[model samples]
Target chain A: MMAVRSTFGRTGNHPDILAGLVFIVVGALGLWAGRDLRVGAAAMMGPGYLPLIISSLIVFIGLIVTIMGLVRDNERLDVIRLRPLLIILVAVAGFAYAAESLGFILAAIWLIGVGSMADRETRLREVAASIVVLTTFGILVFIVGLGVQMKLGPF
Target chain B: MEFLDSLILGFSTAATPTNLLFCLMGALLGTLIGVLPGIGPTATLAILLPITFFLPPLAALIMLAGIFYGAQYGGSTTAILVNLPGEASSVVTAIDGYQMAKQGRAGAALAVAALGSFFAGTVSTLGLAIAGPALATLALSFGPAEYFSLTIFGLLCATVLASGSVIKAIAMICIGLLLGMVGTDVNSGSERLTFGATELFDGVEFVVIAVGLFGIAEIIVNLETPELRGLIAAKISRLWPTRDDFRRAWPAVLRGTGLGTFLGILPGGGATLSAFSAYTLEKKVSRDPRRFGKGAIEGVAGPEAANNAGAQSSFIPLLTLGIPSNAVMAMLLGAMTIHGITPGPAVIQNQPELFWGLVASMWIGNAMLLVINLPLIGLWVRLLTVPYRLLYPAILLFCCVGVYSVSNRAFDVALAVGFGFLGYLFRKAKCEPGPLLLGFVLGPLLETNLRRALLISQGDPSVFIQRPISLALLVAALGLLVLMVVPAVRKTREEAFVDEES
Candidate 1:
């Protein structure tokens, strides 16, 4: 048992600890946000009735998980690579803002162009070609054929 | 006689020109994506959910069903040839299938897998047609108290069957329930957790959550991990399996079909669980278990059949009870809601055409997959060379546009970005997102029924214990909870999942 304990890394169950923290934070947030809503009796449930119960249950589970994490053998978390995560998110967020205002063409180009950069091996020529092709397809299929409400351009 | 007439009506509805065309398109597209690694059927369905709005309800459902079962067939193709299981359900097939390929028996393995899957699909489709009406009729007699207890049972069973820490899965379900309460309450007519967002007054769209979590998060994870591409090393010698191989495969196929059909009906049980269980059963019952993982034909045949059968039968619960068993079924539920078709016991009585039409189309779709997978094997293998760098941009574009199309507003898309980030965090925490989805879909039903039951009983919690069915369901749920606490059962459960990882 001692030998097995040494095999684990310095950090103690990082994944479980992180998971517990997330549950606690989300549960607390739910409680804070819905605090104003009435928690009526079981006979007449208000909007906050189930929400409050579920939120409290979440917090309870979080406490158990956190406690377990402290007692269990140690295990390190996976290395977090922020490059792809951030790049993909920014690309999607940009498209969300651009899709309605700037229209499908620009949004498609921005999405594909910037989205391609999430990978390190992406090339300039491929990105440009994808933007051209995907934009044309989006215009023809989504805009013309499917009758999506978005405009072709900002004009 | 009535069953025959209903089936005939089903065939007539499914055999229509437009439905046939859509069904064929769905099968081909399902095969295309299923053969590709990094894209599963759930994400594919989520991305394409909005596009189906352009199609009629029956046509759309037929196409989606086609994609699902067609994926089972296509997944086995790559598993046999390239040692890469395109779908999670096919992971077990790669064990002996790749070995068969190395022994220059790739064609036999591929043929056996396709044929066995087709057989299993037919049987499960028949099972769905028979069980759907009977189960729906039984459900019609249920009251609010019964439904509340049933939902509790279903939710608890889902956490148990799912591969993870049961407590964590339950917590995720609670989080999902909390998220479901974000919109205006139906009873009180007051916003609960909108946080002053006007767009959220109507509630968060299911498509937004699905696309953000399954679609966007999956891509980011895929990018973070290095790609593993296996080369197809063996030549195809013959397309037909030997008589001895057929004899060995048939009994396994029969056993697999029976097991898959039963498992698929359970909560949180689908192709992945069914296939894993069937493989384990086959290994246990084999006369010489050492042949497994060393070109054993039964190894490929059993799991291939089980996954296909399980995929088809999982639709039974959703079609009959309006309760989705897995994430894919949840997507189907969302699709049904979008088309203004409420899936429940009334669906069979009121919209008989729709229910029967979907059942019949599944059979047609399975037949189409057999034809598509066998002859077009080379085409799908060629597609494996299409690098993720080129593919992901297209997927990212589709996901963005799909979410925007749901409400024709960018707000939903923006909201999905937040979910995408949260989904990434959940992945880092090693939490499975599947239970969260099931919880979100069932939360409203659970709360509504619980409120009604309590209201009728004048706040008496004993109403749950008073009803016979409700008492039985709650007791079963309690039993499952107790079983999970037993140290021996917990160890075996852990061991069962550990087998899949290796």
Candidate 2:
């Protein structure tokens, strides 16, 4: 699974290594947490028992997945693209925050417009036109017909 | 005759102006989304589910079912014309299909696929009509123990269906089940895995995961691979298969129908598998196997037919047993439950009209798909010609609006975004989302039945073994696992799994 990298003077195994380590550690933590529940009398299987079993299974699976990933050398996990992902992430968070104040229709209109504009290819005119047409339809369908009363922004 | 009479009532219900209109509309939309890469039936249905809130349950279901199977037809259109299979089932279509397109026979490939799917749709609906009641009647006697064992069997079969590595597939499923456990524990009313987030209390919504993973992740992957942008083949004329093409394809159709009918019955891995199996089966049975992947008409026709039939027949098991055979079917089942239909053995008996009405509508939708797609092959090809960068943004917008309209919860939209990342990870990990979805949707039911079975047997684990039918099913499950693992069978298994890579 060792793939040759042209640069960095070292194998960039950080991604898989970190993920594998996380799984193994999380599995251990789960096992420790789940170990104490009562096994129950005659026929009752304790909830903790299942968690225990499941945690162990996860640990085993995670270990295998991690090692296999390392061995396969099938992919190269690029450093996290902070710039674009950050914009999309913030926009989605904005979408949630807007849902209440602006209401479903208005918030959605903004969400679509803003989200699309984040990408360079989107045009302002197209976004504005789409906002009008689609929002009008959304308001009629969800608010008027379905009776969901999610608030729109300050009147 | 009684079956015939109820079927007549079904026609009466389905043939109504609104129902037929919705059926046609459903097929139209289904094809549209299917033709577009990255948009599958589950996300499309989830987005449109809110619209159903305004309709009668029957009409809502008819429309939703149309979206589900209708997408299957649309899926192949793109897979053939473009190198991309819009969904897993259509992957087989892309094999010989893209070959044909490359060789200037794009028209023939499109004709063969659309026709083969139409043929399967007709036959499988007939299969559903004749076999559903019989299956339901048989299912009437399943005790809690049997169902619990059957659920286990279903989970086990998922490993058999997974590609690359079966172990990873099962591991993903285990993770899926654990994730499913994040919400409230219904029976005990205990907080199990919430870890305090209010969002976790409600558990992860299926739509969020489906949309994010399938819809959003596809975008990221597409962005990564520049080689996979648009339909690379040149333009073609009228939608007609040649005489030689027809002669080669007819047998493939029959073979595909057989594969589709049975695999479609297996939950979670139907259309994708059916199509591929149809291709490989045609190849193995062919007089010249070398022609298999090299623009062979039989290769394209068989899998397309089988995949379509498999998509259609998958409904039989789910409708009869309340067991979701796959993610899309599970989503449909979820939609059904939201409409207050308890989908189990009694669904057929309690709602015969609803059940048969849906069956009849499949025929209608299939017919509509053929009409819409064949004459409009050029139209769909033109649609593929649209730059994906432009096309994908509109779909993303649809997803936003669709989610917002449904619950009117921005939180849901955020969930979709989060899932998009998760879907990316899944793609990176090389796990098929279908089986994971099966695990998620079926988790609660499987848990409930396992608990009930335990209660019924008073904790006797032998109940599963004691019942002959359950024993048979469990044995079959073990056999399936063995078949999947045997070294001698490994080559055959890969071929089957490849067909489903759609």
- List, residue by residue over B1-502, the lDDT tens digit for candidate 1: 9999999999999999999999999999889888898998999999999989889999998988888888888888888899989898999999999999999999999999999999999999999999999999999999999989988898899889878899999999998888888898999899989999999999889999999999999999899877878899687878899999999999999999999999999988889888998999999999999999999999999999999999999999999999888888988988898999988899999999999999999999989988998877889999999999999999998899899988899999999899999899888788988888889989899999999999999999999999999999999999999999999999988877775542
RMSD of each: 3.0, 3.8
Minimal lDDT window, size 10, model 2 chain B: B222-231
RMSD of 1: 3.0
Q: Which predicted model would earn the best lDDT?
A: 1
For residues B69-147, what per-residue lDDT tens digits would candidate 2 score against the true structure?
8888888878777788877778877878888988989889888888999998899888988889998998889887788
Chain B, candidate 1: TM-score: 0.99
**Candidate 1 chain B lDDT trough over 10 residues, lowest sum:** B493-502
Q: Let me know the DockQ for model 2.
A: 0.33
Taken over the whole model, the C-alpha lDDT of each candidate is 0.90, 0.73
